[model samples]
Target: MAGNSDPLTPRAKLAVTAGKAVAAASRAAGRGSGSVIGGRVALKLDPDLLARLAQNLDCVLVSATNGKTTTTRLIAEALRAAGPVVSNALGANMPAGITSALAGGSDAKFGVIEVDEKYLAGVARDTDPKCIALLNLSRDQLDRAAETRMLAENWREGLAGSKAVVVANADDPLVVWAASSSPNVIWVAAGQMWKDDAWSCPSCGGVMQRPGDDWFCGECGFRRPTPSWALSGDHVLDPHGSAWPIHLQLPGRANKANAASSAAVAAVFGVPPQVALERMYQVQAVAGRYDVVQFEGRDLRLLLAKNPAGWLETFSLIDPPPTPVILSVNARSADGTDTSWLWDVDYTRLTGHPICVVGDRKLDLAVRLEVANQHFQVCENLDQAVQLCPPGRIEVIANYTAFQDLRRRVGN
Candidate 1:
């Protein structure tokens, strides 16, 4: 066993040990990896366990409505150029999961955490991270999570007095509003695809004027900050005015934006753009997202799109027409119960593709697709969906629970 060197108090130490044991038992029992459950047990014993575990570590928290998991993974990999770093690589961003990850990596020099948007403030308070990356915020899980502006307000209030250096997306007005009050902020011009949520300024409730990639609120004089790091088409422009090409295995503009932000965050940790980009190129998948696996004689590439904003970016990543695409959606608790977000996405873009709909919310998706005039086949399960497609590479886009279910079924 890797021994934890942090000088945790006796109670915290016992809690961590118990948590590790429970996690191990969970793995042995063929249940899910017990990061969450173990952390839950540990927090029950010692509420301060996460803070204690995070002590003496240089931590970075990445939060956004989308791309946080991938961005976290990228930042972690880039930071690996520095030394052994602890991270919640499984996309567990809540307090419990974070506690487990920190407890497990007590000896590490750095911690890179993916934080859920709603919990960013709490996590930041506990971790006291050296850097916080604020990615773009969009309406997501409205049934469960707060609205984008509400989340931004919480973030703005939560980060008001924090000493952590914030790396924020300047193109996203909400993100700008949230991170503006921070003492130290590094602005990055990471593009925002979904604009519906940001048209109204979060600062003064005035209509934002966006002219050629720049946003300004005429009423409050709030405008997009000049970015220290900017993403040009297929390239990253650093503060030094050097343009570095982004050659990532991950697809689409979203990952490129993620990589740009990651490189900026990596620079905060003393890793240069070249080294960070090279390290980031090695990441082929994040938590089974974009994983290509052979299942029943078909090559299935998995993609996750949980909200309208995510779906917009995901559409650009799908292979062109003629490649069969399976879209699975579930309204499980993990996925927000509100299916109305479906209407917000432009499904017409998928008109030319071979589409298959599956999961608990297939009917809802089918109705949306039908209204969009896109033809699709409803399948009972992933197996039927895959069988319905032609033999060769197929694309699988699913929401949270549906993606996990299909991943488990495909044994990836």
Candidate 2:
């Protein structure tokens, strides 16, 4: 009864039913965390459920250190114009989440999935995607994993013989190295805001020559490939040498780059550039990302910054000086138990603004801010922290668990 499970085998059907029941029960008990728990249950019953569900559909897997959820939402919106599209709309990227979404939307013919950076190779193999969008990669969740380069090498191995067309960010040396051996590749000159991680070449382990946006290895000559698609601010240059204006409700040049990447992928399936751009403009928020919510009579704009790279890109979106910013950080399990990345963020840029540091690790954030001489005050309570800011247009930036907590409390 999970929207159409007739195509599944009897055993798979039983697993799907049980999973749906669990999800319903969790929601009834007010313990729903999207599809994670339910998907876990389903996969435990039938480990091959995702592969079975993805067999008949044309899937597009999206993976990145940042913007995976937003990018997936953009691509899914673009694909929906053609016909029914199924996606893990909750911003969940693991096997369980993918299974739950595909099972629930069985009747849909297209799947747009956001995959975790570490799980990309395995999930790509299972989904056998028609197109894989490889966004920028940088150091993230260092508490859970040691190396981003190792993951890149794994992805390189994973796509060596894949039949799917890969849309990759050429400015990112790590991304370029990851999809280097992919048989069918379409590169995009999506700007790389964070260059700290890509200072060294992935191929020769030598110093990379980055003289602007163009990068090449000094030792082995692993240079950035010429992009098929390029983004210059809000304008996108397509493979056909045509420029299209991409206007979006979402802020930042990064979002424009995301739209450009989506447009490139959509064009592979005969989706018109105008059509894709039009749909992308309709996405105001993905799950709880970029939502302005009213909580305790205060309107706060929620922004999720999960890692250093994410923080860098998101900080650029904030309206100029004199804006009050609420910075939150949590060292919870889901957020990876390391808070050392806080020191790596360029908090000094926010020296002129009034910042309210609030989260589970508020003290740690305050210490870092104080060390950087940023104008900040420690307010553990989120609501009270917002009150410290100016009256209108407040921006609250939080890490993984803190962001989720704020989104849930705001009732968005």
Candidate 3:
């Protein structure tokens, strides 16, 4: 059911029911159980329906490894603030996912989608986005993907010949160079101190040199532009990292980049920069990445660390704790299933000690945690980690798949 779910989209099924009422009648007669949780797959689509939906709306797509969900959600919210709009309701990215999201919308003037990199060229050709939000690319899922350069090369080719406007991250010099000098491009980034975790020339194997947190160049002199819109001032104001105060909901240096990316794209629709930022600050983080979860009369900060860049950002957070940490990893093919990604993550950014390692892959994490020379308890299960893990002042870092599992198990 999971693999074959993509064919016969919701619209196609409805069309069948319309033609033969008995089909719908039969469904009404049988009620085993359907769905409410998530993960709906319908591979085959009603092409006409998909085309019609695309034809009827002005589109925007946001794609990236780490910040996609939050940035896409933020952009959709900002666009809604400007006027009426629709979104790919769930976190849908593939063609089928996009098709399903459009199936139920009554009529949306503006459509915002979170697109995956592998499928974006096809989607862009079909949807013809008026503008695109291209966030930074980093090494993720080593088992599934080639080097980050391969992904960057594909995107550059896809965009090179397209007519859409672009909103890109300026600090990511490779993506910025690919986006260079398009009149429709408006670069965006954080204040000057926002240095990147990965900066390299995709074309040549050269380490990128940071001229400033907002600008970088390779030894070969491949330079990137300063942002058209930037946020200044430091001390990060909200130190404890539980959450940034009221207005700008998504917290940390990484989220600041996401907010800036969203605001830049919203401006292409004629929303002023200040107005866009004002709206973005009003938006909140989605569940998982930086999504604060309440448990056992205490707060558990949840972050989905699927890649080295994302994990580094989480580990960088100011953990004012009874200090120790709960860390997890996975090599499950479905969950990027290869722990080799651990080698790529710059765990040195993490300070002091990490106390406990949880999840089925605890030993894999222990190997990485050991490099940090921290006190760690490697357990086979998350429940054990929770039992032994101290309640006060703690940080738990889990990958995409484990984040959900942790929420159900130890996080209670």
TM-score of each: 0.97, 0.97, 0.81
Q: Between 1 and 3, whose lDDT is larger?
A: 1
lDDT, candidate 3, equals: 0.64
Clash-forming residue pairs, model 2: none
Among all candidates shown, the one with the greatest TM-score: 1
lDDT value, candidate 2, whole model: 0.87
| Candidate lDDT values, in order | 0.93, 0.87, 0.64
Best candidate (score: lDDT): 1
lDDT digits (tens) for residues 54-169 of candidate 1: 87789999999999999999999999998889999998899999999988775688899999999999999998999999999998887989988999999999999899999999
Q: Residue by residue across 166-207, what tens digits does model 2's lDDT show?
A: 999999999999998899999999999999998888887999
CA deviation > 4 Å runs, candidate 1: 1-5
Candidate 1 overall Cα lDDT vs. reference?
0.93
Better candidate number, 2 or 3, judged by TM-score? 2
Q: What shift in Å separates residue 120 of candidate 1 from its native position after superposition?
A: 0.8
Model 3 ranges off by over 4 Å: 1-43, 181-183, 191-200, 203-207, 214-221, 234-246, 410-412
Per-residue lDDT tens digits for candidate 3, residues 139-250, read 6777777566667767777777677888887667656755663456767654322224355665465787765453444566666665566534321121122222224767
